[model samples]
Target: MRADARENYEHLLAAAHEAIAEHGAEASLRDIARRAGVGLGTLYRHFPTREALLEVLLRTRLDQLTQNAGELETGSPPGAALVSWFLQAVAFVRTYNGVVALMAAAIEDPESALHASCETVRSAGTRLLVRAQAEGTARADIDGTDLFALIGALGWVGDQPTFSPRAGRLADLVLGAILTPGEG
Candidate 1:
């Protein structure tokens, strides 16, 4: 990309991040372009679709989360690692308002722009869950898909005005149900 175009891309991403943080996944694309001081055409040239833009915005963080899972798997006990990774995943899902629904859908749709990154994150979480189950520290009935759904559910709870305050407690309760007694 040319220097000027790259600059515009960066600005658009920054603006989109702010907009999504404020107005959620449904934030207006036109408003994002206006905030970036770019034309709508420019924004489209850079990101052809809303999901495309969101995929770019979230890909780096998703990669980091996947890496964190690997590190936790090696550095901590299976149960502890799964617990820590689960908390982090929930936090990531709540980063941009109203993103939980997008992520849940993306995980199921292979054609979605966010699918690859979401899959990578899910696979990482699966490894952690499997390790914990192997150690008899997590429930055998639940699998990676269940873990992903739990993260989405917790994130959705965090997004609610009435339930946001209780998100931490809710997360603990959910995790308690997933982890075996006397485990993490």
Candidate 2:
């Protein structure tokens, strides 16, 4: 890319990040372009779709989560690692205003722009869950899909104005249920 084109791309990403943080996954494309001081055509040229833009914006964080899972697996006990990673996953889904729904959808749709990243994060969590279950620290009935659903539920709680304050407590309750008795 040319210097000016790269600059515009960077500006669009910065603006989209801010807009998505403030407004959500549904934030207007036109508004983001306006905030970036770029035309709508330029934004489209850089990111053909909202999901495409989101995929780029969220890729780094998702990669970090994946890496964190590997580190936690080696550094922490099975139960503690699962709990820590689960909490961090919840926090990540709640970062952008309405990302919970987007992630939930993306995980289910293989063709979605965010599917690969979401799947990687889910698989990482699954590894932690499997380790914990093998150690008899976590419930054996649940699996990776269940864990991903719980993360989405907790993230959704954080998104709600009325229930947001109780998200942490709710997460604790969910974790309590997932961990075996005398564990966690």
Candidate 3:
């Protein structure tokens, strides 16, 4: 990309990040363009769709989570690493309101732009889960799919206006259940 085009791309991403942070993941693209001082066409030319834009916005954070999962898997005890990474995954899903739902859908839809990102995040969690199971720290019956669904449930609870404060406690409960007697 040319210098000016690159600047516009950066600005648009910054503006969209702020807009999503303030207005949830489904924030208006037009408003994001306006905030970025760019035309709607420019935003479309760069992102093409809301999902596309969101995929880009979430890529960096998801990548970080994947890397963090790898580090934690090697640096900590199996159960401790899984718990720590599970908490981080919860926080990652809470980056924008309603993102958890989108990610959940994306994980099952191969055509979705965010599918790869979702898969990467899931794979990281799965690795931690497998490690825990192998070490007899986490329940063998509870697979990565179960853990992913649990995270989504936690995210949904956190999204609710009245029940948001209890999300953390709920996550802790889930994690506690996943761990064996001497692991948590």
Cα lDDT tens digits, model 2, 45-88, are 99998899999999989999999999999999999999999999
**Model 1 poorest 10 in a row by lDDT:** 90-99
RMSD (CA, Å), each prediction: 1.0, 1.2, 1.0
Give me the overall lDDT of model 3: 0.91
Clashes of each: 0, 0, 0
* Consecutive 10-residue window with the lowest summed lDDT within model 2: 93-102
TM-score of each: 0.96, 0.95, 0.96
Which candidate do you rate higher for lDDT, 1 or 2? 1
Residue-level lDDT tens digits of model 1 in 1-184: 9999999999999999999988899999999999999999999999999999999999988999999999999999999999999999988888888889999899889999999999999999999999999999999999999999999999999889999999999999999999999876
Model 3 C-alpha lDDT per residue in residues 67-175, reported as the tens digit of each score: 9999998899988899999999898777789898898999999999989988988999999999999999999998788889988888888888898888888888888
Off by over 4 Å in 1: none
User: Is 2 or 3 the stronger prediction by lDDT?
Assistant: 2
Decreasing TM-score order of the candidates: 1, 3, 2
In model 2, what are the clashing residue pairs, if there are any?
A: none
What is the alpha-carbon lDDT of model 2 when measured against the actual structure?
A: 0.94
Q: After superposition, how far is residue 164 of candidate 3 from its true place, in Å?
A: 0.5
